[model samples]
Target: MRQPRPRPRLLPLTPRRLPLTAALAALGGLAGCISGDGGTPPDTAPPAVHLQQPAEGQELAQPALQVVGFIRDDRGVQRAEYSLNGGPPQPVALTPNPDGSRSFGFQAALAEGANRLRVVAYDAAGNAGAAERRVTYRPPPPLPAAVEIDPSAFAGGWWDRYGPTYDSNPALADHGVSHTHLYGNDAGYVEYAFTLDRPPGTALATLRARLSSNFPGWSGPADGESDVTVYLNGKEQGTRRVMADNGSGGEYRFALAPADFVAGRNVLRLEVKSGSAKKNGLAIYYRALLPGFVDTPISIAFSAQPLPSFTLEPLYAPGAAAFAIAQGADALYYFKINRQNGFDVPAQNFESTGFTGSILGTDLNRVKVTFRKDLSSGDRLAVVVQAGPQAPLGEHAFWAEGRGGGVGSSPAAVNLRVVACSSGCR
Candidate 1:
């Protein structure tokens, strides 16, 4: 049998309550730990900020730059302000975000040089959060002055599909003669060579010239219209079909690219293309305005390949017994002639004549004779004959003396019959 357990004394239950003043003090203390605004928890964490524009340490051109960024705090942001260069803080409006955050924008009045910008945000609990950035301000430098290249500094000559036929040095001059076409079946071009010290970089260069399309027609699309293909350094730059009103010439301009130029040798080619075989002309006095460039002295003389010297002979028989001319007539005549009577070899000879119009009271004593050699087209000898207003009207025979190539003038003498003009002398 188990021994009976002794009965324990049961103590009476006591219910204790705090004094009213003490309970009130405890509640007040708890309330003081929390936020006073709408029973929210106390906010001890400072606000965090992120810059959205005008990145930190960035250089700005304008002084009045707007700084954009977002500010966040555990408690709602009450107000925000920004201080530039330690100046007085200017209040900025805070925009509420969806994620319990706010954004603020302010235009900072930055001084020249480095500026220290400080943005501060405050919460309802007076907790301050700050974001700082260092920025720089600078004014842009002045632009470089434009340098104009002289027209006479260029070199090269007129070219054709066959080859270069005429050499024009210091390549800027007025040409009022018949030039072959550079486009269509009859193709030709005028090329110029020059050099530049430096490139124009990003700046555009201006090229102005006076030219003629040689298109004789009414003042419409085809009138004064010429197709020009511009090339730089053997690379095609651009093409333009321009029209000119005046017969003397038309003013045309082209904008050259800075990359088209080099420090050393550079070639500028103007190719003229036309459906008709009419002559086109290019005048002098063009301007090449290049920015940040210095002219480089260069020279391009004669053709690429000069033929060896040979003899001179008539290419065809004289068709007429005597050629007729009017008084005071200035004309240039071509004789189909060559050396060795074929296009096998290139040749040249000096020609002289004795015909003085001293008794006729006129200066028709000297005559100029030149040779034009084109391998593709036949060769010829050009003679310039000038007759004064009071020239003698009669048949005159003249003999030509030839030197070099061990050859003499053929056919003995050329017959010339002077006649009076029916209207006016040309």
Candidate 2:
């Protein structure tokens, strides 16, 4: 909250040092005014105090709390003081910062459980104004163990996946062209090699490669070619050419025919050749999708996995809203927000399937929605809502189909809204 500055107060004038005749006249006038039908003085308004920090019933992790507030009055603030619980109060000095805001902070340890913090302001004449808040203090949680990774320490055929790519760290010799592997200038090709722990009877199913483009604002087109060859038991089984898009990067998917895959220790290699490249990044990971056959030796790391189900509830306002399902698995609930078009806002992300139980002791099982920002009392805003894993990999899309509307408009406005589902959808 923002507040206006207070105005200054006026002082009363005092009568002193007069001649005997003037003094006698003034005394007589005062007596007459008191004795005549003089009405009682009007009651004075009390000074007000306002608090701004550590809102009521807040939980804190630190022992020392910073108290922030301001004073309001018919006249300007003269002085301020703070107190904890019912302890003796101390005066607080107000200092203005460069931003034109006045602030004061104090350090004091709070006891466990509920603690009361108070602030009082005083005017020039010693009139008092005060406000306070009740907060709960709790200790902080322990830190987790540290983990480190070394680029050079990585071994096996998978090393190539982490090396330079067309969009990533491109070859300096090639005039910033994207390339895989950073062999010395004399060498022309980069090798991506990885070792696989294949089970004896486990034949290869699909060989998946995961890679990425450049970060920051250095995104553009790159002409590159890659050849992937798979080996089983020290023998070459099959090979395929990697796919490429005109501008965007994509994962390369290769499905093996039965004869192309064999059981036991496997090796995969990728040789990439670049024509023209920019400042881009690349990464590669192989995934072996096997069903029911639990005993596999090779461990595949892929980012595109289905996410768990969850629930959402709106807090603070009412209305019907629609969430645009851009990607990933999601579950949505419908609630009435306004009578017009049945106002419903999308709820926060949840990882649970059933909203049957209470949350934080509140019955939030219903599709309760909360706005990221405040909305006007009568204004209805269209919001695009989504909850899922980050982009490009995971699979899932949800929208009210047919009854709500087509994919273009809100379900209420369009006819036959279509919900599309892709791979890795559960």
Candidate 3:
């Protein structure tokens, strides 16, 4: 609504006689109104600004910023300007809106970390107003150089009782490391286990193993002894006749699609059918492990994207234990030595060494064991039992590695009793 404006006054005149004084007074008043000395004050308030782009607290991946919004004011808006982090202000492209509002847009560079974005609107009277937004920029995680694993590291995991033992053979080459190979006079089955954690996304998983096989030069089909069949988690991955090359073995690599694997673990097996059980004549599927099989783990690799976080869980949980051993964790195991009457037993990890750690019996024997993560040695864990007269007479124990690595056996067994007697003892 507009304020009313003052109008010029008119002159007064007599009906019969002319009054000079009255006429003069009326003329003076009319001149004063016509001169117009008083009026409304010039617009002094700043232009109002509305920013519509780069919403507050937005996370961005790139370094370029697009700013957009409009200017509004009772008086005409003169210009729109923007600044990055309070640096010098620069004019932006302003276009007139149909509703008489002025719109603007511009692109600016964004540096890493927090950026203070300010947009200001100015009126022709030089009055100004502004709106501000604080934005942030973060870079994505880097891709891994490569992901590789070893299968031979888990050789001797489990083997069928009917066949020759599946063990690592050293001195195969100059490396001085052991390779799991088939080299017995009879035929049977040997199994190898492998596992993986949850991958970031779909990945092309591959396994490359050094393999070779040999037979005792039996009288049957001379060439049948060297062919080998392969299986992944019991599913056939197809058979490949590994050339013995006089038993020197060569490197073999293959790809496994994403669907061939689960979120956590997978197992691969190689079977050789060389010395059949017939004795007089048989293609032992080692002609005993499936005919002739040899495996030397080189390296296994998978392509994966970056994941924010992932937790590793074991696939097999076959046997049950007494206390801490009853439950398994990534880095530790837990159990209760003596059950507290009417109360739940708390599970826990070993404190380097101690007794009264109430773990009884053995079931960890069912777990597939590997050498130390750094691939050091295979020494089994020693279970120490501390007993007393007040405690139960006899307690058994189950064990699994609280740590990871190659399989090893316990150095010695424990069954000692520390009987505590008091003055009031019966």
Candidate of highest lDDT? 1
lDDT of candidates 1 onward, in order: 0.51, 0.38, 0.46
Root-mean-square deviation of Cα positions for candidate 3 versus the true structure, in angstroms:
25.9
The residue pairs in collision within model 1 are 181-188, 182-188, 183-273, 315-337
| TM-score of model 2 (CA atoms) | 0.27
* Residue 125's lDDT in candidate 2: 64
* lDDT for 13 (candidate 1): 41
lDDT by residue (tens digit), candidate 1, 248-340 = 344566766655677666788766654534424333323322333222211222111112233323222233333344576674444443334
Put down candidate 2 lDDT per residue, 9-47, tens digits, no spaces: 744344544466568777887887788744543425445
- TM-scores vs. true structure, each candidate: 0.42, 0.27, 0.33
Q: When superposed on Cα atoms, how far off is each prediction in RMSD?
A: 37.4, 23.5, 25.9
Task: Please estimate how well model 3 matches the true structure, expressed as its whole-model Cα lDDT.
Answer: 0.46
Per residue, candidate 3 scores C-alpha lDDT tens digits across 40-147 of 467889987776556688666556776766777887788888999989999877766534567666778888889989998888889999999888876543322333
Instruction: Give model 3's TM-score versus the native structure.
Output: 0.33
lDDT of predicted model 2: 0.38
What is the Cα-based lDDT of residue 58 in candidate 3? 61
